[model samples]
Target: MLKVQEIRELIKLIDHSSIEEFTFEHDGSKIKMKKNTGTSVSVVKTVGQPVEIPSAEVVHKPVVQEVPVEKAATVNAEVIQEKVEIESVTDLHKITSPMVGTFYESPTPDTDAYVKVGSKVSKDSIVCIVEAMKLFNEIEAEVEGEIVEVLVKNGQLVEFGQPLFLVKPE
Candidate 1:
C-alpha cells in the first residue's frame, strides 16, 4: 500500500515528466497509471493471493494511401507557376502578420484607420493591430514607405506569415 503523500508526489512527477505509463506491484497490491489523451489510474488489491492483469498494448495499423500521378504533376506545375509570377513582380515590401489573429485597421472601432493606401509611413509607425488570444498587438511599419495596399479587412482572421499589407518603400 502506498501512502497518500507518496501517491500525490508520484502523480506530480508523472504529470511533469514525459513518461506515458507507469505500473507498480508490491505484495498483493498493484497500481497502474496511464497518460493518454487523458490521465487515468487503476488499482487492484488482494489478500493472501496474487492478482495478474494483462498489459494493454496499442496497435496502429499502417495506412496505405495512393496519390494519382496526374494530380501530383498538376500540383507541382501550379507551385512552379506561382513562384514564377512572384519572382516576375516588381520588388515591393510586404508586411506579413507576425501571428495568427484578427486584423484591426484602427486602435478602436471609432478611431480613424491607422493607414490607408497612399498614406505615408515611417519606420516604427503603427499601421495596424492584431488581436490574438485577447491581446491587441500594435503592428509597426518597420519600413519607411507609402501604403500601397491593404491585404486584409478589419476583423478578418489573419494567419501567421500571411501578408497584411504591401508598401512602396521611399
Candidate 2:
C-alpha cells in the first residue's frame, strides 16, 4: 500500500521534472503520472490486480486543472495595458513572424538587408525571410508602417507566430 505522503511526493516530483511520463510499481501496485505539454496535467493511477486497501487503489484518476492559454493572454494584455497605453502611440505596431524559422533580413548572405530600423514599409513590403524546413519564406509586412523595433535578432530560431518586429503606423 502506498502512503499519502509518498503519492504527494511523487506528484511533486512529476511536476518539477521535465520527464513527461513516469510509472512506479511496488508489491503488485502501480502508479502512473503523465504531463500534457500542450495544455494540462493528467494523472492516472491504477492497481495492477486485487489490492488489500481500496482507499489506496485509485482507478481512472482525476486531472489537474490549469489556466487556459487564451485566458492567460487576456490577463497579460490587461496587465500590459495598465502599465502602458498602446493606443496612444500610433507609431508602435507588432510585426509577428508568420512561421517558425531562421530569420534572414536579406535574400543572400553577401547582399544588404531588405530593410532597417526606421525604414518605411507598406502592407506588401518584404521585411525579412524565414527559412523553415529548407524553404525560404519571404515575410511581408501585413500593415503599412515604419519599422520601430526589431524584436528578434538575425539567424535566431523563432517559433511559429513569434514576434519579429514592432512597427509604428505611418
Candidate 3:
C-alpha cells in the first residue's frame, strides 16, 4: 500500500504532467488514474469495496486498504454538511398512527377527503380515520401545519407508529 504522502505526490505529479492516463501495479496492489479536459480528474474502479464518485460518474470498489485517510475525512465532512443543511431547513414532521387498523381518507365513501396535499391543518384537525375491530377512530393531525404528503392509501392497513401524513409545521 502507498503512503498518504506518496499518493498525494503522485496525484500532484499526475495533475502537472501531460499524460492523459496512467496505471501502476506492484505486490498485488494497483493504482489507476485518468485526467480529463475539465478541472476534475477521473478515478478508476478498484478491485476492492464499492465507491461512488459523482464527478467521474463511476462506481468502483476501493483497492483493499489502499484508499487514503483523506477519503474518510472527506466523507465525514460531506455527511456533517448534509446533517447541518437538514437541521437548517424546516423539516417535515410525521403524523403517525396510534393503533393498528385500516386507514380511511374520508368519513364516508361519498365525502371528500378530510385532508389532502397542500391542506392547512391545526393540531386538532381530524385528518383521517382508522377502522379496527368495527370501531372507527378519528385520527388527528396532532401538529399545526400544512399537509405535505399523505403516506397511506385509503383502506390501507396501517401499523402502530406508521406515518400517515407528512406535515410542514407552522
Residue 27 of model 2: what lDDT? 82
lDDT of 2 by residue, 20-116 (tens): 6888878866666777544332333442445565466545433334555445556565655643554466557777878877898899999988888
Weakest ten-residue segment in model 2 by summed lDDT:
38-47
Judged by lDDT against the true structure, how good is candidate 1? 0.75
Clashing pairs in 2: 91-168
TM-score of 3: 0.48
Tens digits of per-residue lDDT, candidate 1, 1-170, equal 56657868988888765466787777756556666421122333333443333334332222223343334556565655664565466877899999998899999999999999999999999999999999999999999989887878898888899898888888
Instruction: Give the poorly placed runs of model 2, Cα more than 4 Å off.
Output: 1-91
The TM-scores of all predictions, comma-separated, are: 0.49, 0.48, 0.48
In candidate 1, stretches whose alpha carbon ends up further than 4 angstroms from where it belongs are 1-88
Q: Could you give the candidate ranking by lDDT, starting with the highest?
A: 3, 1, 2
Error of 2 at 67 (Å): 30
Worst 10 residues of 1 by lDDT: 37-46
Using lDDT as the measure, the top candidate is: 3
